[model samples]
Target chain A: MADFLSAYSIQNWLESCPQGYLEDTSYGHAVGEGEPGLLMDNEVLRNDAIRTTVQLVLGERCALAASSGLINAAPDEASKRFLATQTLDEARHVEVFTQRLYDLGVAKDDLESVLSTHANPHLVAFADVLLEKVDKKDFVAGVVGQNIVLEGMAFSVFEMMHAVNSEMNPKFCHVLSGTIADERRHVGFGENRIGSLIKEYPERKAEVEQMQKEMSYHMLATFAAAFQDVEAINELEKIGEERSHAKFQGADLGVMDPDEMEHLLADTVLGEFKTRLGRIGLEYQTPVAP
Target chain B: MIDDVHELRTDEFLAEVHSFEFWFQSIEGYLSDSTWGHDADAEEEAIDDEDRDRLISVLCNYCVGEAAALEAASGMIQIAPDRHSQIFLATQVADEGRHLEVFLHRLAELGVTDADAEIAKRASPSLLVFKDRLLELVSGKDWESALFAQNVVLESLEFVVFRRHAAEADTITSQVLEGVIKDERRHMGFGENELGRRLSRSPKLQQRLRDFRPELDALVLATLKETAHHLELDAEEERVLGKGYLESVERLGLLG
Candidate 1:
């Protein structure tokens, strides 16, 4: 009987955490006058924001669906309880992001079209692989892939976004702050469960390490594909410049470069993923360059 | 206001509020013949062949029902929209899992080693149809419809059946049924709370629920007839069971 973590403790933690609910008018201040990026003049910035929100909405929905499978495959009472709470968190993420997209002027049908057509294939494939692990009842693999890798990346990205855009997009920043706290707690569960598995069966360490390598390769592919979209990259670069200017007066917005911003995102996500793996007593094996 | 018809009379339930450990310990005690009056010497003389067979059949049906409830509860935890509901359903997954184990253990005491195979072999056509409909409801897109079928219909009927059987059975079996009935009542409470909240927000949904009642009642009746046949109930007994089920449904007032 695993007594290290109890379901009652998780229930208490969940109850104490802030519920993240965004109102319909929460984003009005970000898009209206006096905001740094007005829609009329910042079409590139506005389109990029909408596109990112749409992608997040789709990704969170995929996560929500996968949590269902994980709950079914959970090996014990504690894991089931933890995964159940995760399902709620993932569903809320989907709901909030969907509403955010709608607030950005995307209709429900248009949002669905974008999810089906414009979602990055590599990201979709990543979700599919994690879900497949859950279907196969490889509970450890599912936790490592979905919670440690995917959610670890989300935590890092959301933290960085919230820091940079707190003033420009207060509503989005507030939402990310709450979500980041939830993701941190989720990753803690993965670390605890994976650590226990390794201690019980030393041979399973090799299998988990191999799975992590495969996930890292997919993560790199997702990032590489994102960088290939010149328009989105250019818009990100402009937003980065604005953020830099806002932080320090007399900073030249012209000096902002897209490749630098891309490298920053990739490095932060990968670095955090490796750090998380180290905490669980697993070494991060570098994937072969593709 | 939501009517009292949707309320669960938790106070009337037999089992005290206990932790999962306590619940499992009680079940273990039952298996070991240390509790519920299953003395080693009396066990051999307590039941005749005919009575043993009837008990085994009833236990098999209970096992099948608990297995179905376990699956539905697992699925519900994933799709529940709010944290409180998800937490409740998660505990239910544990509760149903424990109940299934209890039934399997009780069957083992009767020299039935292969409980799953026995359940499959004894499952009637109507039971199979009910299982299929249950699977569809639990996996459907509308959460309220799932709640209506599982919590309001199947569980409601099971609660009444357990209550009736507990009243008539020996000390041991009655004790087990009492604990199970308590769990069933809590599960039904969750469904009522969720379904009531959803219906109150949308009058259209209330009408859809009203339209859904007959289909659910038909499924319940079909399962009841099959159960009566398995237990070899005469016309009066079948009529009594059917009437009890309908009265329970009327008390729920799900159609209105």
Candidate 2:
């Protein structure tokens, strides 16, 4: 019990976070690594990059709101403390992604406009479904939605982006690396802290599963819309052809189609959700394919 | 324990207060090296069980208050007027979380078996009044009122209480509170800088704040009255608390 407490302690967080992985970091990436000129200068690639990053920003914004709103509703000090750290991590995620917009050439004044303009409606619905649980102060449902589902999704998505950008975009890849680390911690907290609570309130399982199904449907739609962007994919391919190598989750992005990449990401995320949910004694509810 | 209040209206001051980096650095400086049982065993043998129980009771109430602060800080992030304020509130949430955790850790060290039940049992009616009022402000979504209630009203009360207790606290508790005191000071600075500016500009908002004060003041007095025996504060410390609370209110431009 002491070990569990110390592992999740704020002292551990401080030592592991700012003093550890985040030292000397500016906006979750190295200071000197700027966006690649080829992508920044090309109009098609720049818009595509901005479009992709806007989703990240919007997703992180939801994460920020959910994590913050769940703190007071947490049943124990440990959960409250973990959610508090998660709130800051989500906030940092928002800031870093919003910074990426500027790095991709969106003006500060135009940020909100671009975010709203580029935000996929399906993604917005996804956030709304999850935030409703948070707003109602349902810690069980909210954690499932935010930590298990949303963060689970973000973890895989970030990993995929990190892989593809590792060879081409050092700055974006660095940013994703930090967020991936943060998301891993958030998901772990969800599993460790909420498992007992779920056992205590076994009836909450059905309601949580229903919420997960609804959220999963919207998440799938979001992926569908994102992957079906032929123009962006073609432009990305053009840029990729010029580069040497790129891989996403071990699949060669140089030859893998957008649909295949989307499937890979979706499968990875859903697979994580199943394993993590089962660990906490909940069944995974599969949503209708978008 | 801020001995003298600093000027709140300078661009340099607001810039630093509003910056996330400033708060993050402050957190690392104060808390990075400390943990749950950092100095517990050394002090555990010195303090008697009755004293430990008294400390645990006081800390349980603190846990409740810190939880309220965590909730309020978390909600305020969304309604904060700008990116800087939002970012600052983010760090504030983390600070409140750390405060709550350290207190809980102390309770556990005191041989508390069930902290949740102990907290529920030990939290005074006065503390609940204070928490309910703060949560009311947060739920109402009046950003300025909530921020003022939290950063000014609640934080000022905590500042005084922690300062008073630090003198008599066992070594482990004192070390933990020394870190929390620094955080509360930073919170008070933010309230003074932010609310002082807003109150100076808007008479209506000022009046709303004025109307809200009596309830918070009543709660504070009731709380100090209730905890005074357990805390072992003397008349001089009470005088200091009264002076400090008034100074905090005055700094927020609430005084004539």
Candidate 3:
């Protein structure tokens, strides 16, 4: 069987995933940042920032779920089978994140409204372009957009979240860890399949490279929109400092500014994207210099 | 234990049909079979060079249809609402892919290396129309209409064509068609069972299906007429094949 057709490997990965990632709520109590009644008590401004972050995550996952529907238009059997498993994986991610928002004091009634109202416009636009590629049955373009670009950006955000929250919110950290693992597998499948497609039709190499260039611009725009508010940066910095203090016992670790951290995250993600594209026989130029 | 009539059935149909394994083994076995050329001799003796070329054209046309079917099956996997249905559609994807491979291989054996391009250049007009309509159906949000268009109308016509050709085909071609027909029966069974359950729950859906039947009928007949003209069949042969196709459709009760 082709590697793409071997969904049993993904099934094994899902089965062997560590517990507490999907349905554990006990760790929420361990993190004592806010009162349990933060949502009911209208005094917690930090909860607002948390709700916005959750809404951003929710929007990305929902876009992923919608894009999975277009994977059925792939031309080959192996690709179709592999993407079927991916569709289910994306749906599960949506469910996990939606439930996580509910557990984090975002009321169920407010979840969808928050997501629709607060999602970054650039990120949404980026997702729409990727989905439109799939709708047009441009298979290579879709794979590059969703798996390489969107998922790569997502992997970076999840890594940053996991690193910051591991000390403060272990429950949320666990969820991020599981999601990161799934995203890695998704990126691997994309690289492998896109490699094969490029090998078969060498002309697609230029098209894919152009797509990567366009997606990089969208990624920058998304990051800029996300960090435009200085208040949001201050909130994130406070959370980072609190978590760092909890993890390191009064050690004088020099603080990295939020703007520096954002740049580092974007660079790390784009670096990985470029390396993967090169490995798959497509050359990608950095759209924005580091 | 009493059974609920409304309960969805979940049989191990994939295992029973030996979906992938059967096609894989049959194709590998047939491609290397030693008696492959025996049928070629029989065919060459039975038909002159002109008739032989026409028969090859017909075979190439079927190959194109199989390729289109493969695309439709792949698209259905995304829209299927339930796990069982999705799994079944995935198998159909594999089935159609296998059918295309085997047909192309057979065409190659008949010394037609560029069969796909040749047939595309002179593709039957009606088949192209039918394919366009089928793609439109599958691409729409209504999964039931896609199922009805594919398995009931298109596959039913395919079943008739395969059966007709199996009677007059060379030995190896007949053997391949045998396996293909068996798979088609399973696919048709799935479409019937699923569509029946859906229509039972929604009177509105049933009415919609009733209204959509004639359009499907016209497409099927148009394709059949093209096939007859391509093969230069007599008027009697065309009427008999047309009647057989309608009987197959009526048996499925799709029109009602």
Candidate 4:
């Protein structure tokens, strides 16, 4: 009601989106090239070898990644309602993203292959370190881990994506915007309740932060490893263009060197992570700025 | 088949509650100022620094106490349905009642009786946000919906909102947080866990988050703004608060 979203923030986010730019083929669309566009034309999609492998992965797991059928195990009523809403939200998300993957030439599994390249292994430690194997006291712990911790941070970034990339292409704009609305609420549910818990329990702050770091660090590996591959790197660059990261605009990303795009994405992501952590009085070691 | 309860508007509800909140604030104003006209002779000696500190803690702790019960009830309601949800919500109301009693007793023990009439009378920045949250919940009808409205929304925000003040507060504040935190944890756990589970079941249920995210974020940010004002925090302090809030959400895996 009172300039809530901050005019500059909302406007700038919407203004910088890269919705229609993924089709650019300049600079060979190679992964490491400094060009801000991706080479997503017939040349890139023509390769059948990698395309087959991609198809297999997508077919096996097309379901939205979330905890949907867990209501009976809910520890309480309010929680049950919240989960009900969240499951509905994810189902919609899966539907929307599945559609988006179809529109893209990469196919679902191909998309997964592209995405899988960024997979990180540290998710286990984060989940295991803080939560016990059996949380019989209330509900299963993994849902809590996935929905709240992972999705929470993810909501903001996705909103960031929708805000930054929606303008690039009409189709992407639709998917990004529609998908984002769902994530925003999903993330909100996780944040609002959890916020109260931490405020209520100051001491728990330490453990929560520790667990978050482990999870985020593992997630980082997903991004970090993929950035090295030519195809993955190219896809990321294309995503940057497709998503139209504001920094990729015109001749430069406003960074001193074009080579710094990798650092820019990497550092910016991590920095936001730490700042998010600090908002709740939880402390965590931020990766040293590159 | 479900009719959206969020469709309920707050004009009627807020009209009723805002007056109470205003009354509370007017009384709080007296304490904040140096008027101290209430029955001083009863507990004059103890009302010194330590007494004042303890009293503040107790009052806030009372808030913390109420918050705890409300949270538990919320978690219960979110996870259950029909009769059980109703039962949990009712019990939660009772828990809130007890907390009110304890808070009032603590205030009286501190020789602070007059504040009650003014306590909810005039809205402070903090009260306004809290009041908004409360009215929103009730307006939604059925405490199950309200539980989500209150515990998941208001109470959860209050935990962080109150904590900032408690962090620098006297014994009562810390004590309040200590007591409240235990209950609050389970409350949030229930909401998050239940939501996750339901999402696992049907597509319709999982989407509640996406639909509600904007409203929730706006509400949260508004609440944060109100708390920031009440705490008299500057930009840096606000950023610190934001950092803490985001970090807290992040840690809980609440944010994605």
**How many steric clashes does model 3 contain?**
0
Name the runs in model 2 displaced over 4 angstroms. A1-6, A236-244, B1-19, B37-45, B48-50
TM-score of 1: 0.58
Pairs that collide, model 1: none
Q: Each model's TM-score, in the order given?
A: 0.58, 0.91, 0.56, 0.37
In model 1 chain A, the worst 10-residue window by lDDT is A19-28
**Native contact share for candidate 2:** 0.68
Give one digit per residue, the lDDT tens place, for model 2 in B1-256.
1122245445545544655556665666765556662442445557777877788889988998898898889888867887767777888898898898888878877889789899898998987978888888788888888988899988998998888888777788888888889989988877787888888899999999988888788888777766676787777767778778878888777864
Computed on alpha carbons, the lDDT of every model, listed in order, comes to 0.64, 0.83, 0.63, 0.42
Interface RMSD of 2: 1.8
Off by over 4 Å in 4: A1-40, A43-75, A105-148, A159-168, A199-203, A230-259, A266-281, A285-290, B1-256
For each candidate, the DockQ is: 0.09, 0.57, 0.06, 0.02
Report the C-alpha lDDT of model 1 over A1-290, residue by residue, as the tens digit. Answer: 35555532333442334212222222222223232445325777666777667667766766665665676577764566566567656755765676677666667557667667768777787777777776676777778888898888777667656655666677677667667877887888888887777677677777778877777777677767765666844565576644333321222323445455456666777787788888887788786544
Residue A166 miss distance in model 3 (angstroms): 0.6
Look at candidate 3 and tell me the lDDT of residue A260: 57
What is the per-residue lDDT of model 4 for residues A1-290, given as tens digits with 9 covering 90 to 100? Answer: 11221221211211221111111211112123221123234344223213322322222122122233233344443444444444433443443343344444545335545645522333333334323411222233334344455565455445444444444434444444544554555454544444555666677665555555566665455444433434533544564633244532232332233245445554555665565455545565543222
Arranged by DockQ with the best first, the candidates are: 2, 1, 3, 4
* Each model's total of backbone clashes: 0, 0, 0, 100
Ranking by TM-score: 2, 1, 3, 4
Candidate 3: which stretches are off by over 4 Å? A1-70, A107-110, A229-241, A245-254, A288-290, B1-136, B143-204, B211-256
Residue B249 in model 2: lDDT: 89
Candidate 2 residue pairs in clash (backbone atoms < 3 Å) = none
- Computed on C-alpha atoms, the DockQ of candidate 3 is 0.06
CA error at residue A241 for candidate 3, angstroms: 8.2
